[model samples]
Target: MKRIALLGMPNTGKSTLFNRMTGGAARVGNWPGITVELLSGKILLGGDMVEIIDLPGIYDLHGFSDDEQVVRHFLHDNVPDLALVILNATQIERQMSLLLQLKRLNLNVVVLLNMADEAKKYGITIDSKKMAEMLDMPVFLLSGKYGAGYPEALQAVARALRYPTPGMAEQLRSQLEEDAHLESEMARVLHHAVQIPVQMPEHLSDKLDRVMLHPWAGLPLFFGIMYLLFQGIFLLGQPLQLWVGDALGWLRGAALEPAVGWLPAIVQGLLLDGLYNGVATVAAFVPLIILFFLFMAMVEDSGYLSRAAFLMDALMAKMGLDGRGFVMLLMGFGCNVPALMGTRVMRSRSLRLLTMLIIPFSLCSARLQVFVFITAALFSPVAAPLVLFSLYLSSFAAAILTALLFKGKYQNNEPFVLELPPYRFPTLRQMLLRGWQEVSHFLRRATQFIVAGVVLVWLLTNLPPAAAPGGPDTFAGMIGSLLHPLFAPVGIDEQLTIALIFGFVAKEIVIGALAVIYGQFGDALGSALAQQLDWVQAYSFMLFTLIYTPCLSAIATLRNEAKSTGFAAFVIVWSLALAWLVSFLFYQTARALGY
Candidate 1:
């Protein structure tokens, strides 16, 4: 299949356009010498199945940064049949330099002036006909978010693909000599093709950013927004979660129990109770997972999330870390594994390592599921959101403090640069596609791992023919019982201890493990916990789960990406110690307070 490369600077709606073209059918993979991922999808274009690769957003093809180098190598080594150079329409005056430099290559190229709605809103207009005449290429004015002119854009790509290109090595050499001042000169020349508004009217995004980005207000405002998000997850998501949980239970009873009964007792128990129950328990949290990702996707698409990186830069600098590190930490709230991958954007190796160390502490949605589940089951509506929000704030506090301690240990000397996109209303199609992509990704990556862990735990708790399931003589029970004295101070019982052990594989399965061990599911499982533990111990348990060792995949990521077994080992060791110490302190302090 022929290839179409989507090229643009960061936050120029490149990814948005990619999703619009391919309908969110993206595969994420890594190429040589870079840990950053590449997104590509297959789409039918003009009677041919074409591969569209969304290259990393880079300002210059010849730039030196890691992301830029990836784009540069991909372009020169694996040159695509056509390049769709996407430009932010509002910022086209300055962004045109990138398109002009690529034009120097004399390849078949098309300029996609994206974000046309926002551009028009800003009273800016682009003469695509004039631009096409000057650049000797097609230019399409459209909104990637709103799906405006997408068909025409694809038609243009088809036309661009039909053309054969000539070498421009001499043109490239001349351009390279004048590259330093190219941006200003390009802006000056584009004056004929673009018109700007004088005395620009204030934008809604600007009005909001003034408060959201204010030095005195940004952090608190961020926290307030986060509190509401958690509230939404519980308040809005609880009904959906309950519905899903009840449906799964009904399916298990109506179909799985009867279907498995034909097998031998052991097979029936393993299939029905072990794997099915475990998987179902994890699946129950899918509602909240969907809700969180939906909220995040909308926030990201609207572009206010980028301002946060700027708002927190001073705080990050205090810890000798860069704003990019904090941005990766924010990404972790969606998924820690990808957030770890995002650290590749950091130029300094020390900063990357430090950021990698902090990402696991960023309260990923998996862990948040456990927290939200606990609060929804154990606390009042008014108190549940507060507790959930506290957990989030605590996670960030711990991550930042830990980064500060390691800041001097690993010295880094790279400056921070980030693009703050103008906020706009993301289309419902874009929002739904993003949410579905995230949900599918989670299920694809996590289902097998979680089911396996659940079955393994069930087996360990049920083995040895003479012992009862999860009883003292069973493997997990024996192990947990033996460690009871050590765990007792922190109020971790055998069932909870066993659940924590299984949590090593993935945090999302921890609750399912609890349900299996106690021979319960859903609300019954939460009821069992309520009967067994008091408020202090319950809080302590949540604390430990929050700070415990990174999940198995995250640990492997640290080892592979940091390329140091010792560092990965150190992370595990320190995390375990911290989890225990913090849980112990919280439990003890609560008791002393006479709660």
Candidate 2:
């Protein structure tokens, strides 16, 4: 099979193009030695199967970032027969630089000036034939979104496969002989062949960026946006959460309660109470996850995300990080696994490490259940949102402080170069598709990790203690005892400590453990806990869960990205220690205030 690679800079519609070509069947996996996932698919061309690999979006191959290195190694080692270089037509000047570098590799190359429709609106026009001659390869103008010029682009690929031109190196070297002359030649050709009208609408992005990136107004704007996003998540999710809860209760009483009666008591409890409730809790968050993704997708597609990054650059620089790192932090709100993987966008090793270390602090969707359940039960409805916001603020503050501390020791900083794509209205099809994808992922987690977690929590909490004295004497009680003292200063009881410990395996399991534990003691557990556990203790539990160890998948990804078990181990240990300390301080301070 012939091999082809799709290469481009970030957000240049590479994934869109990949989806267009492969019908979204590409297998995605982390590239060797990098956290950024690579996408690959096989396309039939001219009655022959051709493998297409979508490389990570990168600006230049000279960088040391994992993404850059991944591309560099693939180009050097696999050496694809053809490289389909996808460039954003609107940003030709900067995009062309990568194409120039790729030309030096001497691969059969085809240039795809994607997003041609948007480029034309920007008064940017590229003469395909002229570009082809300039680069000594075929050029196809494509609008992947609209499926324009797709057939021609595919034909160009097939032609390249048949002809297999190996003249790119010589062509590139020749162009370098007279840099000014070469540019003039290309410009003259473009002027004659390409006609872009001057009349166009105002770039709405520029107008928005002016205010969104303003020093004084930017921070408030960001906070407002975040507040609205969470408000929508909470408000929209509440109905669904309640509905799911009621449905689960009905199912448990009407069906599961009677169905499991013939089974042993332990087996009955594990299935009816543990597994069933765990899946229900995770399912309840589906609405919130969908809402969060919709909000992010709107921001991203509207081109505000880049402006947000630009506004954050200076603040991030104070911590030896770049504005791009902020994007990863933002992603953590949706899911930490992707957020951790997003650190590949950060070029500096130290910055990547620091960002990864702090990402767990960002309240991931998995932890939203813990927050909502606890706050809704303990605080007023109005106070619940405020309490959740405070926890989010704490996480953000902790991340910034951690970054600053790391900067003091390792001060390498990379420039945050980003392309602010022109703002446009989002298509309904795209929004719904993206939103559905996130919701599907949430449901999958419910079935895979959450279901099993519920069963385990049910078993642990229901199983009789090897020695009987108190709650701490049970199987889970014993395990909780081992880890409980570390959280004593944080006001976390043995039961909560056990939940926290299990959270490292999978965050969704925390809620399941709590459900089983609280349900096991029935009325006694709640009344006794209410008397013993003060508001400070509740606050401390929330804080600790927010900042503590990441989910198991995140740890595995860290190991893959950092390429060192030691680094992953350090991250796990460090996050646990910091969470404990921060929670302890919060509890102590709250107590001192007589809360």
Off by over 4 Å in 2: 1-4, 20-26, 30-36, 41-52, 61-64, 79-82, 103-110, 129-138, 146-202, 439-448, 465-470, 520-535
Report the lDDT tens digits of candidate 2 across residue range 1-595.
7888899888788877876676645665544544357768888888899888988899875666677777877776566788999988877766676776676667888889998988877787678887677678788999887878999899888888997546334322212344565466556545665665666467767787788888899989988888877777677777776676667677778988888899987677667667765666556556666777887777766677777788888888888887777878888887888788878777677777877877877888778877876776566778878888888898889888778767776667566677777776656655665566555665666567766676676667656735432366677787888876676777888888778877888887787667666663222333445665666888889888988888888898878877789888988888888888898888898889888
lDDT of each: 0.82, 0.74
Query: What are the models' TM-scores?
Result: 0.94, 0.86
Q: What is the lDDT of residue 289 in candidate 1?
A: 90
Error of 1 at 136 (Å): 1.5
Minimal lDDT window, size 10, model 1:
166-175
Q: Give the runs in model 1 whose Cα sits over 4 Å from its true position.
A: 32-36, 164-175, 180-188
Measured over all alpha carbons after superposition, the RMSD of each candidate to the real structure, in angstroms, is 2.4, 4.2
Question: How many backbone clashes are present in model 2?
Answer: 0
